[model samples]
Target: MKILHLDKNHPLLFEQLSQLGFQNDEDYTSSKEEVEAKINNYEGIVIRSRFDIDKTFLDAAKNLKFIARVGAGLESIDVEYAESKNITLIAAPEGNRNAVGEHALGMLLLLFNNLKQADSELKQGLWNREANRGTELDGKTVGIIGYGNMGKAFAKKLRGFEVEVLCYDIKENVGDQNAKQVTLEELQEKTDVLSLHIPWTEATDKMVNASFISKFKKPFWLLNTARGKCVVTTDLVQALKSGKILGAGLDVLEYEKGSFESLFTGNDLPEALQELMKMDNVLLSPHIAGWTVESKEKLAQVIVDKIKQLYGFGDDEKKILPPKEYGVSGLGGFFFKTKDPDHIKAWYKEHLGMNTDQYGWTFWWKDKEGNDCSTQWSPFKEDTNYFAPSEKPYMMNLRVKDLHKLLNQLKEEGVTVVGEVEEFSYGKFGWILDPEGNKLELWEPNDRAFL
Candidate 1:
């Protein structure tokens, strides 16, 4: 397959793909319009936020099978429009998650200890330690927004610290041992430090405005390692001035250009940014939270692997053997309780890289002899009686070879069966109960029907 590289990456990407018999080409200095004229020639495109891939660009690429981004966010691309055209979108958030986590922790420590100001004073030969007296992070409650890859990584870094880590995500069941999942209101009420790890979208752009800052019950420190546009610069400066925000450690700024490679030239910056630069309580970096020495290679490798895997050219040669005799071959699905199903589906797609819909993730695998099979992983509303009679938190779905035969055998064995056997476009399904009274779903699948 033909592939086009919009930006230069590590040599391994080109070498690996070329070795796998894919033609590779590069065009780094072309204008967007110039590249658009020739995009239909290739089946794949690799990018790193060099320019916006809008509907116009999507319409031009008639042959594009996929678009691979070497970075975490796909904000530069029209993801919905491209996907509607059957073009797969890929990103490498896992590659740089650790780097971002470390950077966030470093900024938090810098803010808490007043390290920047203290170092500047010491360099000037001043010995006023009282002015730089710092507070500790031990007793603080840290709240994290967006429980995705970056958010989870940041929480993991805080595990050793004596702080209560709370996470507020749009999805339920995102909480882990490192952080407790909480409602956004509860997070704002109890947090002493708030860190943002969300993306830039219509709903999130300028989300942290004056009204949002005012909701916090206490003055709090802020750290933003996510998108710059998520917080309004004017509102942040106002909060800082009014003491609503104790301090801010920002790796990104709202005034940054779309490319994020440069800021406004000369003295053309807005008044809020100018005022922010003069604040002693604030720290800024050039949007390098996820840009580390190791992450450079990791991102390239991740992109290469994903592209290779998508095309079935991966290096994994381990063979999968199918079951010979099947009362139940393997697990077919796992459905559990959740407060919100749609939000949880959004979380799965954003964080775990699962392409999900209302019913949730359709896990596709291969049987022996390279035949395709499918399964399901979904979440139901907490109040739903789907797992009734036993009142269990979850239900297991087992894949069987024959639905009617298994139901008859189960009945003969004196097992308690629930409801009658049902058949749908995707498969035939039946319900039963184990001796412990847990509900189970049996499926004889038709993988092609769903596909």
Candidate 2:
């Protein structure tokens, strides 16, 4: 596949794609107009927040199959329009989740302990330990919004801090041992500190206005490492000044550009931002929550790894697998019971175009990369106890990707997992009991291992 590398990125991404048989063109300096003019020439595009991928840009990229954003947040991209055109959007939020989580925690600690103020005072030759006294994080009820990658990462990091973390997401069944999932109302009522980890969308823009803050039962500390637009700057400033918000730590500002750099000149910044800059109770960073040095390589690696998975890039001995268009991709293995396995196998060989082995009939096929792969078809003895727990006479295996992700999703949806996943030399396997009591086998194949 031919890809357009729009924004500058680590060389490893290009190198990995090249190794995967993908031809890429680097045009980091090109203007949006120029890039749009020739966008249809490539099958894919890898970018950061160099420019917005709106409807017009989507229209220009008629031939684009995918858009890989190097970092998290697809706010700059028109997701609805791209979906209508079937252009897959891929982002690397997993790469920088830890960085963002750590940054958010650091900002919170800085605000809570008055670390920034203490350091500033000491440097100024003023020692006022009593005035700069710190507040304990232990026993505090911290509320987390949007418990996805960043939120979950933050929750994990907070485990040692001895805080009662309550997480609330619009989506339900997201609570785990790390944080107690609760309703937004419950979160607002009980939280001593609130941290935002939500993405910026139309529904979320200015979501945390004065009215939203007023919903809280008491004054609380605030932390936002998500998006600047999620919280209305003016509303937040007023809340902080009024002591409705005790302290605030923000890594992003609503007025920031799409590229997350300064949108306005120093003289042209919004009135609220100017006020925030002068506030002692507020801490601000230039949207660098996920901007760690380690995250640079991680982000690139994640995007490249995703690209490889999508295009069937690794393992030269095994061809790339076909993409599943529906719920299940293909039959992993088909099994049935018979009184006489050998007789049935001979009968199938005599009638159907089948070559049966001692164990089973292995159907071979080439992957997208023209590598070897096979699926097994076998007939077990009628009295075999392999399908024991269930008295079913047959068992079916389904092929899947990201096995753990699918398994977790199933569990969250309250599906009955038969047992834990078992690893074998050939692949990783798991079992689930369907509604009809059929023992279904899920396999994430390791084709190379079989070869």
Candidate 3:
């Protein structure tokens, strides 16, 4: 399949894809208009926030199958629109997690020790040891927000630091060995140091402002290696000025350029930012916490590996892609347990006009595409354990077009599909538990084989 490389990335990405026999098209300097014009020519695209992938872009890329992002953030991409079109998305957050973790630690250490100020003073031949006294990281409570890849990495790095780590994520069950899972209020009440590690999403935008800071019981130091807009700069500066916030170590800023490419001009800086720049207590970097030399190569390598895994590259060419149209067509079968299978079978045969055979009754039907199909009805013994895990007395199978694709959609919709898809000579079968606790079976029939 043809793949478009729209943004500048590591050379290893294209090299690996080419080795896998995918036609690679690199256009790092294309305008948005140019990209839309040629989007239909490729099956996939690789990007790193060059431009927005809104509904318009998705509509234009009619042949596009997948979008691979070189980094973790998807703020620039229209994820919902792409998902609606059944476009696959791949991201490489794991690649730069270590770099971010180390960078956050380094920033905190520098701030805590007043290292920057001391170093500058020493270079200028002024030795003021009394005023440059530093604080210890040991025995301090550290709060971590968003315990996904980046948060976990930061917690991991703090293992030997003798700090009490408390993690609060919007997601459930995210606590691991490195930190104790706690509520947001609990974190605010306990921590002396607060670190942000979440993505730039609607919910997280400016999540840390005046009101958020007021919830803290202690005057805490702040670290933000996550998205810039997560913290309201104005409120942060106010907090620092009021002595509510001890200090801040920011790798990202809310007032960053669109592409995160340029340093801010002094004349154009916001009033709060201008004040922040003059503060000795505030530490800043150009959002390069995850841009280490090692991470650059790791990011590209992870992307290539994920792509290979998704397409099953080199495993089997035929299984490289899932079926396109995934939808339910009709009922495949109806099953129920009875005290007397013979009696239920006789009743169905007598009252329902079903011509019962030895195996049971079969109702023949045709689909929208005029394919012949059949539905089966059977009654099993009351004590049967065919539905072993679920004690439901009955099971009904809905015929579907693509089993894997349907399962994927069901998962996305918050419907919990249970177990692996079971394949038999008759069809492929799967199961799910409804909110009411009924175990429902789904089937994609091998009608041609039966015929």
Candidate 4:
């Protein structure tokens, strides 16, 4: 299977992929038209944020199978479109989770110990040992939000620091044996320091707003190695001014592009950011928490392993490449909605040969061969709002070998495949609406690279 490396940057990734036996096309800096023209010839494509994979690109690709992103975050990729096209998407956040954790810890240590200030003073030939005091991490309660890979790594590192770690995540069952699982309120009430590891989701944008910060019981040290927009800079500045927050170790800031360089020379400073810059207690750095030499190599390996698993490639044939995008992957239970749960369950059982269980009229089916096969379906009230948009239901994509054939089979079995076959640069795919108007995507790739 032919694989095309789209971006010219990240030489280490190219070197790793060369050892995997997959042929790489060297015309890395292709324009949109060039990529669209040649994408159909390749089975696999690795990208960075340099190119945007929109509907046009998806429609143009006839053989594109898998997309490997080298870092964390999917803000640049058209995830829905790729899934609809049946393109397997993989990312390498596992490689950098530890890096982020260590960076956060290092920044916090520097802040609490006044290391940056001391370094500056020493450079000026001052010997004020008495004034340069420091604090200890021992016996402190640290609150961590978004208990995913990065959050878990941070917790692991804190184990030897003699600190109590409290974690609060929207999803349950993330508690580790070492850290205490607590609600947001509880964490806010007890923490001496707070670190954010959450993603940039709709619910998490500006999550650390004014009211959110007001819940803290003490003047806590704040750390944000996550996305910049997660914290409201205005609210943080107010908190700092009011002595509600002792200090902040920030790797990101809202509108940081302007502050990082003198590019916007004449522009007015946002009131909040201007105030933040004047505070000595605040320690700021550009976003580099997950950027380390070791992490870069690790990210490549993680992406390579994911691609190998997705395509059922042999260990010897697996190739490591730096990714251009990043996202989360794991087995997750989904809540489906249907007008007639029983009928849908029966259809899946009879046509798809799926194993399903019912609770009242609702039915749930788990992939027979998967670990979590004991899935169930239950009835809901006629007016039940559980499937409503307000619940923010998840969209599941079932990867199929041949989307057209699968659609035909479902159609023959009296199931409605809602959408027409949409052709994209990546591949051809379609969608179907369940009994409750919930949309599920079916993808089929035209290449063997994603076998």
lDDT of 2 by residue, 1-451 (tens): 7899988888898998898788999998889999999999999999999889999899998899999999888989999999999988999999999999999899989999998888888999999899899999999999999999999999999999889999999899988899999999999999999999999988899999999999999899999999988999999989998999999999988888788756644567778888999987899898889999889889999998888777665645465454533234567788889999999999988899799989779898987768766788999999997775677899998877656877787788888888789998767888888888888888877764333
User: Which wins on TM-score, candidate 3 or candidate 4?
Assistant: 3
TM for every model, in the order presented, reads 0.72, 0.72, 0.70, 0.64
Deviating ranges (above 4 Å) for candidate 1: 265-267, 315-451
Judge candidate 1 at residue 380 and give its lDDT: 95
Candidate 3 positional error at 188, Å: 0.3
Higher-ranked by lDDT: 1 or 3: 1
Model 1: per-residue Cα lDDT over 1-451, one tens digit each? 9999999888888998899899999999999999999999999999998899999999999999999999999999999999999999999999999999999999999988889899988999988789999989998899999999999999999988999999998888999999999999999999999999999999899999999999999999999999999999999999999999999999998878778888755667799999989988999999999999899889999998888778876364633444335467667889999999999999989999999987889888885557766778999999989787768999998888777887888899899999988898878888999999999998887763322
Q: Report, for every candidate in turn, its global Cα lDDT versus the true structure.
A: 0.91, 0.88, 0.88, 0.75
Count of clashing residue pairs in every prediction: 0, 1, 0, 20
TM-score of 1: 0.72
Angstrom error of the Cα, residue 5, model 3: value is: 0.9
Candidate ranking (lDDT, best to worst): 1, 3, 2, 4
Off by over 4 Å in 2: 265-267, 314-451
Residue range with the least summed lDDT across 10 consecutive positions in model 1? 316-325
| Residue 385 of model 1, lDDT score | 93
